[model samples]
Target: MKLRMKSLAVVMGLLVLPGCQNMEAVSPWIDVGNQVVKNAGYDTDSKLARGIKETLYTSTDRASTGLSQVGAFNLSLPSAARPVADGLRQFGLGSYVDQLQDAMNRGAEQAVAEAAPVFKQAITGMTVNDALGIVRGSDTAATDYFRRQTEAALRLRYQPIVEENLRKTGFYEQYKGLLAAYEKLPVAGKPELDLERYVIDQSMAKLFTRIGEEETLIRKDPVARGSLLIGQVFGGAEG
Candidate 1:
């Protein structure tokens, strides 16, 4: 899976791209790459799935730090809601919240890990001609295409796992406790949160977002491809 970095580095300089962040501006190269992808012997779908899975690993690591770890959820809420939440969390309510969240995160991590094979298999319709569609379409087109094609299947596959994890985490009980505590305060308003749905939806959204970014990077950045198959498909275009 080692890509030709030195060659790619030389091409990157010749392409006049500023940095990895700037690759989106050179999407026209997608047109060039697409032609190569079609004629290249490797499967673009497999490469894409692997890249996305790798991206998911990196993304979920970051997300775990921000969303699944201790006090992670507390920092992300709106300012108006923070003071009351902070006061309660200062007492021991936050421990339950963090525990529930950590459970959800662990579940999501498992689901995402399980999803790599599914993602690869989901692209069953990925013909050689599809490369052109990916090139002509927007940055998120691959993600959009994949989701549009397999969203229903993905949900069916992921929901049960999410629900099971939530149960294991005691999310429902914690949510009820949190809501009751909120309702007890004379000044506290009802927070109407669907905890189960929130975890499921948020996990799916983050997974997809990471996948889309991986798709974009594979199409745009030489270094990000990280595979001989990827480089062969995309390298000859700019080489």
Candidate 2:
């Protein structure tokens, strides 16, 4: 589907506002939009579902694309493994550590690509009941629903891609070499971590964060009300 980039770009800009981040701020836009749809000879249920799905697609597209860039994941070695990482750096092997960090982030970036199809399928499956509930629900209601529908499936799909990218980036080899170096240290503690699982989990968490931000923008940002139907469904009621 063709994304309405003009609309989504406005929504993205609105997200930078502190007030737009308030998940508890209520607005009557959705109700007004619903009324408008009702009066426009459009079936409220179908229009609501389509509008939400279209919005979600734009949101998910932005999230996935933004996250695919290098350094986008912004994660580091877990705290438990920090000592080991520090030790590696102390031995002038810090570049290796940096490489591993970049690899993990890159892996996660690649893994995020899996989310698009999953979200598309999930959004496509959205029920009229789901649409009604989301329209009447909290600011993040749509995001919450999207998460419930896609989280498990996303995890299952993200892991292998993450693992593959990690290997491609030589993270495993560098990690093992670092661990070998750390073992030679006179330290009594060995830091253990599941890097693959960590990347998968963090990637999913960040993906949801992006989606939630978009959902909130749609609910609260007047500029996000782009299309005629979208504006009608999300615009404020002129009292």
Candidate 3:
């Protein structure tokens, strides 16, 4: 009876061992398991949402800063306007072309810097279904989600800034000058372009591209996961 009692006491002590003993190493999974139902993928919806939001926050910040630099949006003239641009280049009026391209890039760079708040708002407002789809879907799922949710708003926000910056940079006058020179040449087609819309569209596309790259990095590179919650949620860290 004494031996049995002693063994029972040892088992009880082991059972009551504090959960905090290796908490730094164990807490992430513990928190996950408490709320998760252990699906094949094994993540709580809330944790998944939090992890994705964190990832987007990091992605947006990095992309915005990187894309806001000089020459960051080194976009070419629109394809529709290519003939016009080529004609100007042939006529030795290339300075107008250079000035116009530079102005578009400058406007895009300035407008992209304002995108973080819009991205954050979209991340904050994602639905449970949206989070789940992002976690289980393609590599660019989060980027796609951002596009769907915030593209219109981002375009609306970006247009005025881009227009203002373009005006400040004399893009309109340079573009008109380029067109006038191109019209004087024997360019085959009268190339039409919505210059401001083109700039906004190109900038948004590049911004999404950067964001997609970040999402791919976060999913593939453990170092890019950036937090215990993200690692456990996305990287399958079992407790």
Candidate 4:
């Protein structure tokens, strides 16, 4: 009986010892990081919407180059609309340049509004596999996927609006002016600017930049760890 009691005491002592307790390390950082990604993706969608809106409102150039005949016109006219005609003359176009700018901006704004929700859903639904693939692929692969998936549907939805805006804003007449100007220029092989496509591409590029920023944070920030798997996979310390 004495021997058995001594053995039991030893077993109990071993069980109670801190090092023998088989404790696992718990990391809160991963969870925090995941939540941050989700939130940032959502926030990025909002920023995308705002950026599109601002770009439309403030943009004077149909090409979105920030410097254009329209901007020059605005500066020259200052108060009156006469510089618009002068701008057309400088470009050797007709009186339709101003109208084209308006039409392009309107189309861009509408396209962004229609596409924002789809983009948000895509970002929020991104899986670990998707993130990993993005990390492994080209710098813009994630953004490219988002664009590929969304562009067709968005273009289909946006085309009618763009067409209507173009007609309403007299884009045909504006294009005539542009064509006239183009004919006078020595430059050849002028690439056609598909306004809807350009707007969508630019927006996707911006969204990718935002997603990449969040991803970088997830990779670097220990406090953003949101899961046991993530902690186990990424955390260097033995649990």
Candidate 5:
């Protein structure tokens, strides 16, 4: 009885614990948008929006190619730094993890392209305060702001697109099968991870990394700004 109770306790704790592999690590916004700019009193063609659009137009395409390639996620800092949870790795689903990781990158690759217009529209809502904040903030400052404000919005806007694309590729089936296999193991406990949320968050993170890289480059070298307005706005920062 004690042993059974202890196992239950462990599973419950794992359920509640927050980490990448743990369910909660998927982000609250997952469990948790379109009129945002109109509500902010800025139209799609607003100056802030135009600036962001231009910046993104120049960068997003290149970012897509660079980041969407095979092995991209494995090469990212996030992969190395993200904790995979002891239980997940101990289950020894190494090949499953590899395939899942590849699927995540593939899903994200398309997501970035599909999300471009949404992100561009989202830029229309950026306020002067937001501009000042991003300019004065870190390299990924704008990306951070975008995540805070639009992750939920983006999720709503982007989820269907990602779902459709992944489904067509059989990515969803593969991921579900692997996860189901894992969960069937006597010691696996209830599956704690949300593969959809994990992929979405990772997609945004990688795109943000690309954006931050561009932002940092623009800040350091005048040539990369792609426009006078962006240069004047973000050029002074040392990031």
Candidate 6:
């Protein structure tokens, strides 16, 4: 009996030792993940700025296609805001649309160019906890957090630019024309169209969507798998 008890104790100790070490190793990953998320969140402005730049550059290439479909010289309109290389068949803007598209693209390019460094600086100021939450949450969580935190400030900062872009792209004029037509209709309770609000909402939605895509890629792709601590705490390799 004495021998059996001693043997049992020895086996239990061995088991506990490995378990403790495993737990310790796992703890650091959580910290690392938190740090990464926080960093990502803080840098969201930069990321968004970069995304805008890419979008604009790509849009420039598709400007002609947009024009052919719209028959208008306004690109800042909702119709021409479709993603690039995705075809311009849907905007239905009619002819001269290319001019609008090009101008819109140029304005977007300018806005991003002006905003990128500001966004970068903002991101650099994010806290570690903020980063962790973003890193650990859903793919779009970080972007969402950034938007929630910075939207007000960003709007204040970018509203003038958006207005300028709208004017430059002829959206301001076209929007007024549409509003005039709408006002003449006998419609009741027509919601006022705030162009600035609409543009900001649309731009933010697209930006978040792209961030979510990146998050999905990070979660599923083998190449990006190494970026997160997958198998240890969250479950084994199978989990």
Model 2 Cα lDDT, one tens digit per residue, 56-175: 777778778889877787889878879978998899999877877787888898889767888889988889878766766666678889899998898888888877766766556776
**lDDT by residue for model 1 (27-83), tens:** 566445433544444344444444344433343344333443333322133344457
Clash-forming residue pairs, model 1: none
Measured against the true structure, the TM-scores of the candidates, in listed sequence, are 0.55, 0.73, 0.72, 0.40, 0.53, 0.46
lDDT (Cα, 0-100) at 122 in candidate 2: 93
How high a TM-score does candidate 6 get? 0.46
Q: For residues 146-168, could you state the per-residue lDDT of candidate 6 as single tens digits?
A: 55655566556556766786677
lDDT string for model 3 (189-226, tens) is 66657678889989999999998898777766533455
Q: Relative to the unseen true structure, what is the C-alpha lDDT of residue 128 in candidate 4, on a scale of 0 to 100?
A: 52
Cα displacement (angstroms), candidate 2, residue 68, comes to 1.5
Q: Which stretches of candidate 6 lie over 4 Å from their true place?
A: 1-98, 169-194, 221-239
Clashes of each: 0, 2, 0, 10, 0, 21
Worst 10 residues of 4 by lDDT: 18-27
Pick the winner on lDDT between candidates 2 and 6.
Answer: 2
- Estimate candidate 5's alpha-carbon lDDT, on a 0 to 1 scale: 0.53
Which segments of candidate 5 are over 4 A away from where they belong?
1-62, 68-102, 165-192, 236-239
Q: Which scores higher on lDDT, 1 or 2?
A: 2
Candidate number achieving the greatest lDDT relative to the actual structure: 3
- Which prediction has more favorable TM-score, 2 or 5? 2
lDDT of candidate 6 vs native? 0.44
153-204: candidate 4 lDDT, tens digit per residue:
6667666665666677545566557657865778777553444444445443
TM-score for model 5?
A: 0.53
